[model samples]
Target: MTAILSMLPPDWREGTFLGRLDLGEGPVPVLLAGGTVHDMSGAAPTVADLVDLGAFDPAQGSVLGSAEDVLARAALLSPVDLQCIKAAGVTFAVSALERVIEERARGDADQAQAVRGGLEERIGGSIRSVVPGSAEAAALKAALIEDGMWSQYLEVAIGPDAEIFTKSPVLSTVGSGAVIGVRSDSDWNNPEPEIVILSDRHGKAVGAALGNDVNLRDFEGRSALLLGKAKDNNASCSIGPFVRLFDAGYTMAEIENAKVLLRIEGPEGFLLEGESRMAEISRPPLDLLRQAFSEHQYPDGIVLFLGTLFAPTQDRDTQGRGFTHKVGDVVTISSERLGTLVNTVATSRDAPAWETGISALYRNLAARGLIGGRA
Candidate 1:
């Protein structure tokens, strides 16, 4: 328990955080401020409601306990509720390259190394230097297409538009300390550690959190149509410890310059570490946010994952197989200002089924008198 709590930011006590906490009754919105975790149920029914309201005062909330004591007695949820979960892909040069490798190899781990070497030699430097949608990017694209090296991944990577997709349904995201799932049948897969933005009903960026976007390389590699199977699954999306609201101390600058770190400790004594510097992203974070909100509405709110730059390529067991998660592997994602998110890896087929959904949440809230009635 101590170790899990230690995953939080070193300076957590000083920051303002919003999250969901289940103290055996049901999940309730919690506010951590002035070194105490306060029950914000009096302020709002759900975190989504509190965020949409946009003016919650911690002093008005009832004191639960110190942050440590409260977290110790309760299970922390995904820090988001009733919000649409969205994600951007191929926002980094390395991720774009990996997607191309996955496509060329057709999900075959054995063929990935061969394709990786050729792809890197062909357009690696060019891709890194050119800005997405720029004339230089267009010239490079034309050259790659002429050379027969163009890919759908590259088109999205360097194209005028970004690739934004629904990551998971509302109330489906598991919190830190919960088991994160990958497809059982997927032989090639990895965890994507990213910094997620919390947007209000008005599509305004209000806060940020850490997330593990567990992915199945093999599934998506076989066909783009398998994206649903490869991406969304039971226990697949893990976000939290908590969402740190943007304030005078922790602002957009913290998120813009944040260095998201990943560490995986396998059951068999395999250790791997990597990082994704926000500085290396091909598209600005807000640009992706605008693209996601373009011609759409998320009245409840949204949790948007700014694509990761850390795509593990280290060999886990087999020499050329690259990195693939094993059951019991502990994945930790942390940033200086946003704190840490830790979760264990499990096969989607074996992990606990996603039972509590929007209906269940509404019923629980209504029964607890947290809300008027179920929608």
Candidate 2:
């Protein structure tokens, strides 16, 4: 309830949103409609089941209270439960360049600036303008290869295939107002603010939420194979506030033009701000979704993180060393439609351990007598 105004969508009453709320007992699916919060656990115990049900009529459940009242008292949770957390990387030209910088620098923060300047000068324009997988992209690829500047990151950036990977475990993501972690050993790390799509089992986007894909540039820069370590960590993934379901007033088109804003306020008076315009994304969100769902199945649904365009290069403390997170830094990611997701940074070693899994979720649901079937 602290700074509650900044947490929910500005148009909370107009936009139909879905989220999980824990009012002491356990996490349950909740719906915000016409400014009222409805307990959806009676209709569907989990948000994933609610998605499978394909309907969010408030009339189907008992009213908890007004949105303002409920949100103040209940603990907000990540919008999706039981869904695989997946993310698309290098979907934006700037992000692609940043990845290249990380790669060329070999995760060494001191070498980033030098590598970035030359990399951008050589290929930034083409990467920015050429459509991915297009003939122009292919030509650019051939040209880069000829010049010996081709990279694995470039292959995913302009090549036919996109970079999609499992971001974290199903129940591991922390919600808004929680502590997001960065590995203590990582010398270069930052948050990747993104628009996460909540999709059904068939890969159809149902709603969207704000997400922070906490990234460790140094680890992945050391080796592409280190991506798993660079990304997944205790309290690494932060999502929500709420999932704004697509409706007449808000749809995919709104998301396509959403300008995501990021602000980092550090304890030592360090402040950094940046924005990611979805309009500049090299690949379409739906296209990324298709690549993610190509041959895999998410029976319980999936939350796909559309890659970020804002890659922080601003100096945090050192003269030439790029941005990196510090403990106690408050990171905020927000957009007009998705409201705000705010979290304070902490080292992964110090953050709370993830103890709950799918089994615990089912047991809790059964204990409440809410797990049998959709009502």
Evaluated with lDDT, which candidate comes out highest? 2
What's the CA error at residue 345 for candidate 1, in Å? 0.9
For 276-340, candidate 1 gives per-residue lDDT tens digits of 99999999888988998999999998999999988898998889889999999999898988888
lDDT of 1: 0.89
Model 1 TM-score, all chains together: 0.98
lDDT of 2 by residue, 1-375 (tens): 236446877788898889998999899898899989999998888998899998689888899998778777888777778999999999998999999999999999999999999999999988888888999999999999999999999999999999999999999999998899999999899999999999999989999999999999999999999999999999999999889999999999999999999999999999999999999988899999999889888898999999998999899788899899999999999998889999999999999888878888888888888976432
Q: lDDT values of the candidates? A: 0.89, 0.91
Model 2: CA > 4 A from native: 372-375
Residue pairs with backbone overlap in model 1: none
Runs in model 1 lying further than 4 Å from the true structure: 1-4
